[model samples]
Target: MDLDMAQVRAFVHAAQEMHFGRAAGDLGVTQQALSKRIGRLESLLGTKLFERLGHGVGLTEEGRRFLESARRALAASDDAVATIAGKDRPLRVDVWGHLYAPTRTLLQVAGRADELRLELGHGRDLPGAMTALLRGDIDVALGRIHPPLSPGLAHRLVRLEPVDAVLSTDHPLASEPTLRPEQLRDSVLWAPGALERLDFLRRFADRFGVRERSGSVNLGLAHFLTEVAVDPRRFSLVPADMPLPDIPGLRSVPLVDPTPLYAWSLLWRTGSTHPGLSTLAAACAGEAGRSRWLEYDPTRDWLPDLPTDRAEAHSG
Candidate 1:
């Protein structure tokens, strides 16, 4: 027997959702019915698409390869049906986050006259957004990385934002133009609750000598600065060029010693034939709005002037 469109649709939906019940809900069917359909499809294909891992389901390595083909097939099928039905629709691509403002400017520069429409999505950070990109939920991601990225992913530097030691305006250090690393040795910091960032914190702490730390993901940059502003005893590292919040109590003082800098990049799956990827890259690297990370010097080689976005060095 041949695998029908319905079966393939269910398989693809299951892979994306990673939950039998949710996939069934998406398809307007019972979990049992969806399970049977997926099983039948797997039997026809002679390979399992998912692995039962505790309460959740994960795609097998083979399933990952199949997903790309499945997505392309579905897209083609949709295009054919739309053509036959005499309906025209826009191609959709997803963008995530504030890390890459140049991307937005590029899209706007293309003007509304262009045929392509971009759909933007926001996320907490690069890691969360990149996961969505991998699952085919989103097309592109603009995120920050210390170094090192996944093997099959590609990225280009968008900017090299410098970090500053932000504190309350009344704080003594705030009056200074720049602060030394030793100034922060005995200072307290409000840190993110994420475990993934803990290693970075430890390394930074050892280098700068952070004496006290508090873990609170609930506190955003605004709140962290607020605490410092009110008490004048706490501080947090913030991007140097990032506009200091309008709140009267806060100010960002540059860290002169051990100045930490971060690279923001655009990421995409290498094998992806998605048109949006190239469109995004061109926009980001446009003539007027080239990546902010580039050091524009008339004498320097333009190619090497930009920060390296090689995947191996960015993988975390």
Candidate 2:
């Protein structure tokens, strides 16, 4: 009995995305091709794996059961192929902090890398991605890694991104070329979730004397910026390098005199040999050096904690 790995892989992506068009885009295949691949896979398995839904696809019982086995099969195949052709298998990577467009860091490195084949997903946040990492659901994740990572995980500090203060054009400080963190004390710290749970913002507010806070849902960057543009007293932070949407009546001002730095790290499980691990790390290192991404000055910049140890050096 022989199974086509391509068909299996197409099915896996379709299952993960639950949207045929998105799955096709992820696979770099046309939608028709992806649908055909899924059809072939279902025919070979003699089971219906997905139910057509009004919006996206839903996994049937068979698909839910087969997902685990499919992942294992891919892992086994990847491991076997790594001995000779590691680049052939796609390395699963997850990223978070979409509000800041984390892919700006990833795609820059990915554009320069030639050795790695990647499949990227948005894990939404650090905690979510960490859970997936511990469970072996992904090969790598890129995000802000705070301390207390689970055992068997390793991390490499990849980038130090300087964040800017986003405020309404009507804000009193908006006209200033650069504002200090202390200036935000007069304004409300708008955020997605509770201030206590938002580690970075909470710490920043605690240290900077921002006592007032309020915000809406944790929507994407545009929505958050739009919300900021609504009130002159509300402000938030965003990566300075990220491209901002052309929303009306919003201004992004740089926060100086110890600017907050969002540390982006590459995380993976230790002791499990994934061939692309070293390749991806090397690629990140290369891009970091070429782009000066890891530059952090204690006097001019701020981070919640000191730099994390590189791959295999430390784990929680």
Candidate 3:
């Protein structure tokens, strides 16, 4: 079957999003234009590609089978371009972060001028980052995956850190090294919208019948810290490992019962041809970035012990 690179790539993206409008937005194309292109490709293939489900779309069985081949074709095209351009030269890549640590490591590793010309974009949340990735506006994304990733995106789990309830050190609960969800009902809770969809938080909130009452706060981490710090009586929960300021007497206690753990990952478009991205993916899979964090306190990660490379100690 004859196929053009652009149409195949567009089809793969639309299938991944399962919405023509969203897919077009990701590709930076108008919905009408994207529709015409898909129509052209469908005509060439002599099959219907999507079933419009009133408000959205779904792939036909044939579209499902064609998706992987289309992605591979795009990857091959990227490889061919990279070969013509030479790998030794700096590569251009885009990365987005929405208050996740994996995002920081991605920027630190990819932004090195010697290896890559990295373009850094910051989003307020995971949806925004994923949208940018699908649109090809960003090549890599450092973000959260509460529901996990869709088929066309690749994810590498980097770290799983516990959550802490931030409050004034003088608060009654501050003295305790850890506090359970049931014990936190009396304290004012601050729920950042970005984390609202997180499984741990949702589960914990549901158990206590406190999900509806929780106030939505700023999505940005720095703003979150400032708001909580300013209000001595109010508290916000965040990843326990993220550094916070000691404002005279502010303290953070680990949430015991819920033990909310944030799963961070490095996400990239599956068809990436950039050699540096592949290197980063392999390194992350090997957990090369784990050793850089504060010495793993057993109190934090309760998992069975795993060995890490000492070389990672000095790399970061």
The lowest-lDDT stretch of 10 consecutive residues in candidate 2 is 307-316
Q: Least accurate stretch of 10 residues (summed lDDT) in model 1? A: 296-305
Indicate the worst ten consecutive residues by lDDT in candidate 3: 303-312
Task: Encode model 2's per-residue lDDT on 67-112: one tens digit a residue.
Answer: 7677556656655666676545688899987777788888899888
Every candidate's lDDT: 0.62, 0.82, 0.62
Q: Give the clashing pairs for model 3.
A: 26-135
Q: Which stretches of candidate 2 lie over 4 Å from their true place?
A: 1-87, 310-316
Supply the global lDDT for candidate 3: 0.62
Clashing pairs in 1: 147-314, 148-313, 148-314, 148-315, 148-316, 149-314, 149-315
Tens digits of per-residue lDDT for model 3, 212-297: 33545546666656666656556666667667654556677887644655555667777776676776665554443444442344
Top TM-score hit: 2
**TM-score of candidate 2 to 2 decimals:** 0.71
Q: Estimate each model's TM-score.
A: 0.69, 0.71, 0.67
